[model samples]
Structures are given as C-alpha cells and as structure tokens.
Target: MKNIFSPIEQIDNLDAKVIAGIERLATLFKSSLQDTAKRYKLTPLQAQLLIFIAEHSTKLCSVTMLAKEFSVTKATASDSLKTLVNKSYIEKVYNPDDARAFSFVIVDIAKPMVNELTHFGLLMSSSLSSLNENELIQLCHLNLKMLNIFSQSGLITCRMCYSCQYYQQKNGGFYCHLMKKELPAKALRLDCPEHLKSS
Candidate 1:
C-alpha cells in the first residue's frame, strides 16, 4: 500500500494510482525541459528560469522569489540568474523601493529562444487535446482544486485564480469579481498576472 508503483492489481486505492500517473506526467515535463536545456547549452534550472521570466511579470522574477518557486537555495538561484545575465538572456531592473534588490526581464535577443522554450509543454497539451470539451472541463476543475490545496499549504507558489481575491465559488460554479464574469472551468487560469491574494 505504501508503494504507489506496486502492481496495479495489488493497490486498491485510487489516490496512489493517480499520484503515480501525475508523477509520470511530471517526468515528461522535466525530460522535455532537460532536452531543451541541453540544446541551448544551459542548465535545466537556468532554462526553466529563463522560460519562467519570459512568461511571468518581471516583478515575480527576482532571485528570492525564484529560489522559493523552484525550491532551491538563494545562492543557487542567484548563480543561475547570473549566468542568464552573462548570456544576455535577461536584463535586471532595480527595485524602486530598494536599490540593492532587482528583478529580471527577458532581453529582446532571447525572444526567439524563449518562444521555442515555451513549447516545452506542448507535448502535454497535445496529449490532452484528445479529450472532449466536458472531459477537459472536468479535468481542469479537478486539477485546479488540487493546485489550490497545494498553494494554500505552502507546498508551492502559484498565481492561480483559485487563490486570487477575485475568485468565487457559487452554487457549484466559479466567478471572477475583478473580471465581472462567471468563469467556465476551461477558462480558469493556472497563472494570472492580475492575481491579487485573497485576504
């Protein structure tokens, strides 16, 4: 029972199987990122950090935040970021409140590579493309529920709608107060720049 990888017939609990499947999916994502990193001559974490900077707001790309996000030490995050700066993939912007602190923005020259890097998730996306609309909706809703739980527990950091002040659940449906609209399960965002933590 403790081993999720025990033969499927030996494990009766659905949760273990589900976790095992998710771990496999995570492995695929890591493999794709690793391959991309090798091609770009960058470390896996550095490549991931570059992609993260390209997609997220610069304010969220600081060394401190990046370290927490990736579960790495500040020194490791800072070293990777320094490598990124040396490679000219990103430029630093000083914090207006504290000149000693800074964040990063992807450089123009790295846009093409960043665009390619963003496709690292395409394999996962494509695998799910075969699901019907309702199935996709159900999957999205369940995944969001789990993600929200993980975020709430401080196991991870996320800017998801489920954790945002604007998000609401009413009569078994979701709404976004900031957007002034009901949110269809498929429309829910895994990460939103406009996210404001719920008080």
Candidate 2:
C-alpha cells in the first residue's frame, strides 16, 4: 500500500508535518479503540458512548447531550444509545427535571470494561516515556492550546474549562470571567455544563 503521509513529508513546512502527525495519531487511536471494542462485540461508536456516559455526570448523559458532545445527529446518538441499552451496557432513567428526557447510566456489567478502556493512556504511555516531566507538561499545554483553537474554529467542540471563553488566568491564579470568581486549579472542570466557545 502507498504511504498516505508521504506527501506530507514532501510539503516542506512545519504546519503540514504537524497536521499530518495529528491525523496519523487520531487514526492510530481510532484503530486501537476499534480493536478493543471488537473484543466486547461492540462497535467503536457503542464503546465510545459507553465510556462517555460512564465518565460524565448523570445530568449530562441524556441523548441530546450525547449528540451535542459527539457532534453527531440526534438520530445517530439515539441509535447508538439503543444498542448500548440492548447490550445491557447502559440503562436509561427518567429525568426528574425534564419529563420528556431520560438520563443514561452505565450498567454494572459495563463498569469493568469501561474501566479497562479508561486506561487507554497505558497503551500510549510507553511511547512518551522518553520525554522529561517538563517536556511532557509543555506537550500537554501545546495540545490544549491546539484544542482551544480547534474549538474556536468550530472544527471541534471541547467542554474543558481551558477551552471555555470564561476561563481566564491572572497573576498565576485561575478564574471564570463569566462567573466573576476565582477557581482553584484542582476545581477546573473537564466537562463543564456552561462551557462556551472561546473567541
């Protein structure tokens, strides 16, 4: 087979190389998830839905929320959720606040599999072992910056506090400009309900 990234090397630009690297990394990550999902007789989408519901708070696990989070149509999210429910990987419960909406929760049978999937870092950690702690931190910061850019461009959506327009830093202290309050570093949310796209 031809090398898909070979043309990237011939581009003679750092941006091209960086974009190609990100694309290649995403492909590899998807392949890893596909392999793992196959072992459990689930599609990658189903596995992703299971993991998302397991990680997020109950209030955020509705089908509409899943559709928004995954950038998929509501019908697609509903189909995936139905499959997970059929497999006993997740169950839907009536939402107290919304009569028409239901919230999802991972079933007990799926907890162990979800836990195993959450260790995905272990698969890639060895490859990053050569980097020093400072280098790792720098890489993380760069990745987060890229994520913010992608989110702002509408190429992606991220609910991380760092990606929100309200997130601000002054004098080495974090704050939510929208809420007009300081936030502890440890309290920054990974999936915030009020996340707004940063300009």
Winning candidate number (lDDT): 1
In order, the Cα lDDT scores of the candidates are 0.88, 0.81
- Ten-residue segment with the worst summed lDDT in candidate 1? 1-10
TM-score of each model, in listed order: 0.93, 0.81
Tens digits of per-residue lDDT for model 1 on 29-100?
Answer: 888888878888988899889989988887899999999888899999999999999999998999899999
Clashes of each: 0, 0
Error of 2 at 15 (Å): 1.6
Which residue pairs does candidate 2 place in steric collision? none
Per-residue lDDT of model 2, residues 88-165, tens digit only? 889989978778878999999889999777566587888899998778766876776778687777766678778788
Model 1's alpha-carbon lDDT is 0.88
What are the runs in model 2 whose C-alpha is more than 4 Å off? 1-11, 172-199
